[model samples]
Target: MKIVREARHRISELGKAAAYSKFGTDVARRILASPADSVVHKYVKTKGLEGSVRRLASESLPPGLYFAKLTIKQWEKHRGKPFRLLQGSSVVYGNEVEPPARGFPLEYRNIVVTSSDVTEFKLDINAPYELKIGRGAFTTPQQVKYDAQYGVKQYGDVFYSLRGNTVNPKKLLITFPGFGPSTSRISYAVSYLKDIKEADLRDTMMVCFQDRYLAAGSYMMVDSAGRSLYERVWSVLDGLRSEHNIDESQMLFFGASKGGSIAINYAKDFPQAHLLLAVPQMNLPYYFNKPFFRDNLFRNNAIRSSEQPESLLRQYFAEGRKIDYFYTNSDELSNHSLIELAHDVPNLTKYRVDGGHSAVARAALPSMLGIMRNFLHGAKNKTFRCENIRSYARGGNVLAQARVDNQASKIRGANWYLEGSLGRTKFMHLLTEHSYQFLKFTSDSQVLAAAYDPIEAMSGLTALEANGSRWTSSLPEPLTRGPKQSPGAVLSFDELVLTSTSPREYVVLDGDTHGKYRYRSYEVDPAGDTMEVHFVKDAALSVDTMLEANGKNRTSYVAVVEPLANWNLADLVALRFVIKAGAERLRIVLHDSSKRQMAMALLSQVDWKNSQVVAASPTQPEANGTSSAALHEKEALLSNAR
Candidate 1:
């Protein structure tokens, strides 16, 4: 009976081996046999990171375990066919209904744990697909080690984490991280702790601002009856200067995008601090992501022109500040503010790269750190090709122009990458495949990336696609010459600017700040500046909520105002913003109905004063600030001023 049982067990083992052999053969035939089907090996080689990674195509291996390879574009096109995720990475997942907005998380999309069920189920996507998925994109950071190495220091709502040589450090670096989902570490720049140390940077003490005011950051510019975040940061930095015994000259300010803007703003007071900014959003008011940030940070949508890089950068006129703006030609909105600022800025070093706005910050980081290393050694970095990028908007179409001081340098034939608000998703459904055109050669100094708006009256109506963005190629003039401009009001740039701001307050872009370089736009009472907008109800147009609530808020106040100009925030990174107000709080909520948003101010915990009471002090700008001017742009375009 025992011999019979042993024979049966051997037979069972042989059967299992045969089943494995059969399944392996089937996987090889389906994936490795066909040239169309890439054997998605669960394992492939990579650099820096261990284990398998992904690239384009690879030769077939003796498939022990493999799946299929296809792109969302390929599968989406001929969808019914069984294919895979092929080209430039796009997540193929289930349960998640995220709009795949730019900079969205990837871990939730790709990862599954042991507690998960992997049984037969119909995919959400109405098509079939396969994948030889590599190890998931989820990994735990050494939190215990990092926690011991770093300690946080908070001042009011503004705070920063200090790391590196804290004991009598030679050089100091204050880093600011741009907009990243706060599910992870808010001190993202701290992740580069190891990288900066290994670069042989001197005994440097690094300061990484958490900047996680509401979500990610409020630009660290909150002010109340108490000391403002600015003052608190000032006190902290002033203490650090004495603690580290390092002056502004020996310190380096580094940031990318939003972080860069903050660094630039702070560095205005300390021009000696070397600045390394990348694709920074200089004009906060006109920023595409302003609504999300504004709603999160401000009490009202009153944006201060003072809260911009251009205003801060202009302060470096008397003294020289080694300001290096590591910018990518592709960052469209950022260029609008940066290019305009570059024209008048002195001792400004601009490093132009060819990459995306979000990606270029990280991509340019190594070079940015090298600049810090140079400061540590009191050396100069002359490696990067320096050039200035300028953009000119005429008849609603913008032309990105490049210039260089070096006659030997070729700016004409360099690659200039450009993308509009809609990026690649414009072609998502129409073409059944989605991608954006990024590279345009400076190969011809004459090459230009021009933006065309069909909706801009008859701004030629050259490029037209229903609900789609359009950027004309590197054509010298009117890209692929189409329609002639219809007779319409050709508004100058100043007029366009005037229309956006209040008529009563002529915002002098280059206003005199007496002596305070930090004080930005000064509202000079332009002789008899008044607007007759028959307000059925008392109303005022104010952007102060979006910027700073200078003085105290009056308890007796109007809850809301009428409409102003409507801003379309659906196309850019259309993340829905839901307003959750506390009891007895007044919040200006943007109810997105068919992509249209309500432009309102969040006037909670705010004190206001009537304009009639402050009429005596018309010249007093902060007095004018109390009488709020709110823009309401929901369905009807109107404004309310009180």
Candidate 2:
């Protein structure tokens, strides 16, 4: 029995070798002749299946076929037939189906189908089709149709589709699509379709490469040795150039997200090629560390290389290759470090627009087209700059200044305007020096200025107050006001000092009263003739003290006063004195019974001026929180002070 078993095993080995030779392919031969310890060898050994692996060796097997069981009769019948055999559904072949075509009739003449007890069969030989089987099912018809229409090619682990007229085309557009599942390639296809259709591609050839390894294996662009997957794309492009007689100089690479990174990677290679990237993930290593992708395959790959696109683009920048990059402020997936890197690249033209990573492409298509046209026309580089000229208050006028910088073009004129809830009003004309100043009515009002070029076209728009104030000066005299005084209360500072029962009521820095106030880096010297508060450091000095009136809270500081007191003083209001040391402006706050804080500013007309006095009316609270009589009295006092 042992001798018989040995003979059978030797005969089976010879049969396997003969099967490999008959296949006439290196891959088939290699897989068939693999060592017994190899995965393929072990698989065949355990499954008691030798013919199926040999037959499927020439073609890429669907993921499901790894564990499929084929009957001896089925293997004999289907062997050498060059067909796609799905595990459970149907066997798809080229142009012909065997007898007994079952199931409903189809519409297209090229495709034939039939169902049986064992399996179903389909045949379509007229068109080139992509067979991608996952688990136990064939890919969707939509994907198969797309692959058939466009000539899909698989290189390494990536599957890409290339479609366009290559005969004497004016340009070549290569698009690297964003990532998706292994079975689906339409997520980014839909994004590129609009651009592809709108693009003047009659003279352009477009190629789209899909990122398949992201789904099949968790392998990002880098290999185990930290090399980029872009090398493979380059090889493919080189092959296309050689076969189609294409010029690499007129190429434009476009991508978004992951695809955008690939576009940047190869932008330097083409030299003369242009790039249109939208919210690209330029820093792969940094992106992998993000919370969204920390556990994905991209993170795993990043651990190996520590590679980032910003670092890689340094060489590209040194080569002086420019790229047109579009990004939105709202893209959560985009890294700000990458955006800063792109902005720093002297050759790159950055466009910060509206929308997220995907929507921005559609939102900025019109601008993108203009940029593409300029590139094609070989127009000179142009940049736009608009900055605030610095706001100033002088001669009872609150002037807003805006400076327009047309880097390369001459400004014809500009329409200086103020935009607010009242609607836009064109107020002043731009000056010859490209600076315009207009009178702003309210101190809180913002200035909106727009600059136009020779064509009366708006070049740029800027808001003056966006970066706070560039200059600080006093407003008109009428804008400065002290707190309102009571109707008939009058108290002298010396008289109050003698009559006050609690010293805390009047915050005085005496010789032993150091902890009376919160002194922030300032000391009060009682030895001086008058109490002098001086800073130990050159920094600003400030002191804060809390006050209470009728169970309400109020806070007073050296630089500002926030009065929340609502005391029912029968006829007298308290008085506070502030002595100025510098020409800095002081802000004071007063609260109504509604608890709303209203700011009032007092400007110093001269430095080292005498002490200034401010007074506030005691609150006369009513059912509606404030009395009309008290409001009228307070308004009168404020009007008098102003």
Candidate 3:
């Protein structure tokens, strides 16, 4: 046993040395800048912080700078007493309470005590509580003692690496594999966990282990086993924390696929730790009981039971729970799970993108970083809702922006179109398996919308169709039809335009919003086919009515929209919108004229509903109405002439 333990330690050291040997001197210096104080180290010295450090380590990477040891400990025992067996009946044919009926005539029995043993390996590091430092590994072995406390038991292997520099205090991310039936193959989790920790992230450490093989992918085990494993993990974490000064918040739990489920389970048990996971099998029952996947029991073991995913989620309501779920629209395992969870847990955030089973690499990582950054920076509520839409709009130049809201629900980010750009204004928003692209155009009204890879089109938003169409409409209304009614008609901001009297002032001669109001404009265009309009508004601004014009000319018109309630426009008053006469206009027959024209013409007249335009006929003085067009940039505004 000593020899085996010694060999494992030597191998670990050798591996570390080899890794260090590969780095340039500069890189090596960066990794080993300076060692920080560790609560775990002190705890280990007094054996006081073992459990705490172990607890912290289970969820995070060690903070500051440090190294860790991955070692195996053997847990076994022997029983000296003879074990007894139960026979069918007691026969007293011969005498002396005939030796309990052996089998048939002359069947013999021997007394022997059944013995059981288990193996558990621990991976750890000593660090401050604020910066949990340590690694842990676990796995299920084949042919484990059937009567063992936990059906299948074995600890995984943990590997260590440095993160963060003297300049930046780092956070640790520790990953746990879903299930494994052996120690050898289970170590794969450890290797990959370390690799991912090294990329892109600067001030973070990663610790992980391979999953043990269970049939094929089954990782579920009896509750007793899970508890025992959890306890062992908890013990190591306790030790690390008591000895090290690692803060619970600095530690993060991250995992993917089967590992992701493991991460969630750990966080559910220990809510104080920061948790991050992608495409976790939260709904394990659905995964295992599926008729099509009936043959697999290996990975299924780690997430055993035929219960609903809701039942599994119910296990996480212990006191204070903070967990983040990342899933791709293509992730069959977690896509729906995330949505369902999103509805219930306010703190639960579902990061959706475009991708499949391998959601982490394709979708979760890139998007997750932004979320983690917010979390690490002490963001309140820390939960963000994201959607896709163009946010950058500077007279044709548009960039994608990520819209986020604070705890008070106040929005943050530049305004472009569609109420903060539907939260998809940045490259960070993941809406299914695709990573959204922020778009901008140098001149045209066009903006870019793209994904990392192909994905199903959003329900209301169509995927790029034939000839690369930007959007496909599915609503019952005409996919390309204009608003049926004005005044009462609700239209999106992009659908309306306000003529700018100056660069900073605007009047709505034609708009879908209700109310007579003035607005502050950020931009104006008079030379292009499409003029850009940016304005500040209040509730009083609104559209009155949109009317379709009769006649083969196919021209449309609209009426002056009145406010539901009167309002005050302190700075700019009224509005005038410039549009591609037909694009933003509706076909409407207004009292103003029999001929069809742009909706702006009817809306610009104060008595647009009662006045009429004479076609070469003498106009009656009573037919005249008040005109507010000249007050603003009527030059850019549509004319009342039909």
Candidate 2 residue 155 Cα shift, in angstroms, is 5.1
Model 1 global lDDT (CA atoms, 0 to 1): 0.37
Clash tally, candidates in order: 41, 2, 142
Question: Which lDDT value does model 3 have at 503?
Answer: 24
Off by over 4 Å in 3: 1-171, 178-187, 191-205, 213-228, 290-293, 296-320, 335-341, 372-642
lDDT of 2: 0.37
| Candidate 1 per-residue lDDT over residues 1-642, each given as its tens digit | 999999997897576345335443354333322342233532211122222111111111222322221113223243223222222232222221222224423122122111111332223344443333321222224322343355543333354677777777877788876765433432233324455663354477788875533223456554311123667777777788887688778788887778877888777667678887777775564453332232223232323324456556655533656776676545645654233223323556455454467766555444455556566654431222214333444442333432223431322212222321211111000000012122122332212222222112111111111112121222222222114434222111121121222232111111100000011112222221221111111124342222114523322111212222223221111111111111121223222222221222212111211111111111234324333333332222122211
Off by over 4 Å in 2: 1-141, 155-158, 180-192, 216-228, 242-247, 290-292, 302-306, 341-344, 370-642
RMSD of each: 20.0, 24.8, 28.6
lDDT of 3: 0.32
Global fold similarity of model 3 (TM-score): 0.35
What is the Cα root-mean-square deviation between model 2 and the actual structure?
24.8
How would you encode candidate 2's per-residue C-alpha lDDT over 23-86 as one tens digit per residue?
4335554665577589977877589655455343422322223112121122234323333334
lDDT of 3 by residue, 1-642 (tens): 999999997998576444333232223332222232444344353755333333222212112212222122121121111111111221101101112122212111111111111112111212111111122212222112221221222233112223433134355456655432222222223324322323334655444433332212333222212222445455545444444455677777766666766665555445577767666764554344222233233123333433333344544432335666655444433432233213334345444344356634443443355445444443322223333333332321222333222321232221111111212211112322112233211122122222111111221222211111122222121111112311212122221223322222222211112223333222222222222221112322322221213432222222232222233221112212221221222221122222224333433342111122211121332134222211221222335222
Greater-TM-score candidate between 1 and 2: 1
lDDT of each: 0.37, 0.37, 0.32
Q: Quote each prediction's TM-score.
A: 0.41, 0.40, 0.35
